[model samples]
Target: MTSTIGVTDRRALAAAQSSPPPRSSAASRRVTPPRDALSVEPSVVDELLLVCGVIGTTVSDTDTPDRIVPVADCLNWLQDLQRALRRDDDQYRPISLLMAQWKIVPQKLLPLVDSCRYDTDLVLTVAKILVILTKPLAESTERAGKLPIETKTKTTEA
Candidate 1:
């Protein structure tokens, strides 16, 4: 037996056959600003350093250093993570290293809060580092994904 289209089907077919709505003029289309035209926020850096400290603590059981040397030492490992977040570089080994370190002691990052007072731009650069450091590992839950991430407590000497 032959079946006829139902009222709903007819209406849907009619709608499909109908012409599309009027198009906006090309000039009316919205233009996206250039990358350089956009400004990065400062608060992101606070998040960045916090991520880095989490990564650092996760790596080798070292407490957050009052000085920049230890932090700088992490530069090589953190570079990849930085590039991933900052979109400025090609290498990601630094980030890989930071991940390796973080995998060792994942829980250690819970206490060190971000409380830095530097230029918003500078903090953003650092913030980029932190975001790249934690996100990938956070996405994984495999045994091979422990990521050197540790969760512990310690004290630093000045």
Candidate 2:
């Protein structure tokens, strides 16, 4: 069945079918700004470092070190821990080597309540990481069907 198009619908259809304004060569060839230039916030490296520090301090079962060496050392230790965790096959051999190299105790993997300056900072940093990791996934989801589309419906009174 054919439906009658209202004035609003006609106007919208006409606008959609009309040709867009022509652009000059200079306007068309204008250089777009770099993506980095649009960013108004600090880089994620600091947040990543903070997260590494938090995880490192917890794994080391020691107070946060005053020097940068300890922090770097802690980061290495965390990497080792991650590798160990992922080593499902040949677990014994890898764990033994990790234990020998870092002397890590899996039992003491818990973070103390007062380990970091603030728990919220860790939470926020972790959230930032999650956002970064899931950005592509989120974009794909949006492309799939999450994007909004404008539509018009007509009503008739008898």
Candidate 3:
């Protein structure tokens, strides 16, 4: 009887060992971030456009007129929107407006590129428009970054 009990215990132990360990609820509930995680937030748009502005400024400085044009246009657009929203300190409205504009304008603008046979004139025009469109988000993102993380965190926490 002792030997039988020992065999049964060993079998149970072996089976337990072969099976995977149970996961904690937190571990089991782990979620994969969406592929477009950045796009999920309105501020993310501003941040991205801020980076675009930085890139555009760099390109413009480097005298890469062709490449700079597109990047510059994106930057300018973001900056303009930022100015408009901050004009009377009426923030939050610009994000909704800019996002709507981007969705609509890109559809019309993209066709112009192909329609013009991707010529220098057309490229420049697109770049100009993009610069104008990007200005607002860029400035807002810049200002937002200027605030200390601790301040933002504390404000949100409270």
Candidate 4:
């Protein structure tokens, strides 16, 4: 048995027949921002670092410039996380956790953090990154502390 469209089902059926639901003029092509800020949980640090690790691995690639979206997203995530941590005085543990990650992150993000670039906002973000998680590079003193064994040592003997 076939039933005609009921009063309530008319618009719904018309909407279903439409290829794409009509959107208001207000719905532009702009990307909307995230719904929520970074979570307050401390465990978010691990996931953040994981994203850093992925960025680090691909950062050396030749096409990295073309992949700006993900890099921007990761950087924004970092900033969001920093803001969350700073809100809680006693819970701000990024310094030590980031101290451990300094070896992995800064080197990868170095390209984006360059202060000489034209983007002052990037430079500002770089400064914030330094304040948040950047640490001094580890030096190679193992080789630096010793001179070449074969070469004559520079003696200070008088």
Candidate 5:
């Protein structure tokens, strides 16, 4: 899990991320953030990606632990991301495509859910992610489909 930083590294690794302002911050402040404050990063997208990666990897492995504590923490982290995603902010709109690309489907989480059935918080967080992902995605997320294929097939009579 440390290989791909998640909520645990939120503070230490926060300095390097340079995500664009969400629609909520369309009027971004001009004042420069203090250097120490750089570690106080705003975007949770990378954390979300990491959480998904962790869950996906754990699901694929046959010898995964009986209870993945990190996944529980990931659920908490995802809850924060869900809150950010639920806001009526266009800047965060691009994240929908990310969620789709990462395959954050309800079924994708069943393995962990099965392991954590006793934990109500984890169950509810999974439900929240499922509910949020089921909604119609923002138009910008369409780019998630073909972003890798530029499709520039032009032949100049070679």
Candidate 6:
């Protein structure tokens, strides 16, 4: 009986040592490291820029010939959006409205959502931009049902 107990304890210890530690929930898991910049293809960057241009042109207030906005302008707009999101502003509404009006579906917006399996810095960059653009919309929608109209107007005015 003593020998059997010893063998059982040894087996349990060996199994514990051999197995990996249990993982946390998916929400608590660490994000995968972004791909290196040099490995990103130029065509991927260009495609991302093209999508940005389409969105920028759709949202721009100034007169753009043929409604074709420059890629650089789109990049600047993205940077502005990033800053606004950091400040927790409502700048997301314009971009959201533009996307709706232009019928730019998720499939056309950020290729990263569909192609993240391909490791690339461009994909990561686009993914971050999309997150910034969509987060405010998500938060606002959540609050819309809970907040009174007066409070909503006051928050927006601020």
Per-candidate Cα lDDT values, in order, are: 0.41, 0.36, 0.44, 0.43, 0.53, 0.43
* Candidate 5 to native Cα RMSD, angstroms: 22.1
Regions of model 4 farther than 4 Å from truth? 1-42, 54-75, 84-95, 102-105, 133-158
Lowest lDDT sum, 10 consecutive residues, model 5, at 33-42
lDDT of 4 by residue, 134-156 (tens): 33322221222122211122349
TM-score order, best first, reads 5, 4, 6, 1, 3, 2
lDDT assessment of candidate 1 = 0.41
**Lowest lDDT 10-mer window, candidate 6?**
145-154
- Candidate 6 Cα RMSD after full superposition onto the native fold (Å): 15.8
- Candidate 1 has a TM-score of 0.26
What does candidate 1's lDDT look like per residue over 86-147, in tens digits?
54212222324433544522432222223323435444545565565545432122222333
Give the per-residue lDDT digits (tens) of candidate 2, residues 5-111.
Answer: 67778788889789686777655744433333222122232332343445543233267543222344443444444543344122122222223233223322223
Error of 2 at 145 (Å): 47
| Model 2: how far residue 50 lies from native, Å | 22
Which segments of candidate 5 are over 4 A away from where they belong?
1-44, 54-72, 88-92, 106-108, 137-158
List the lowest-lDDT window of 10 residues for candidate 4: 141-150
Cα displacement (angstroms), candidate 6, residue 76, comes to 9.0
Among these predictions, the greatest TM-score belongs to 5
Instruction: Write the residue-wise lDDT of candidate 5 on 13-53 in tens digits.
Output: 56546654456552453233232221212344555555566
TM-score of candidate 2 against the unseen true structure: 0.21
Q: Write the per-residue lDDT of candidate 3 for residues 1-158, one digit (tens) a residue.
A: 47988999999999999999998775575443332321224454555345333423212345433223344354345445345434422222333344444463444445445444456754565555555445564434444333322111112554
Q: What is the lDDT of residue 50 in candidate 4?
A: 58
- Evaluation by lDDT, superior candidate among 3 and 6: 3
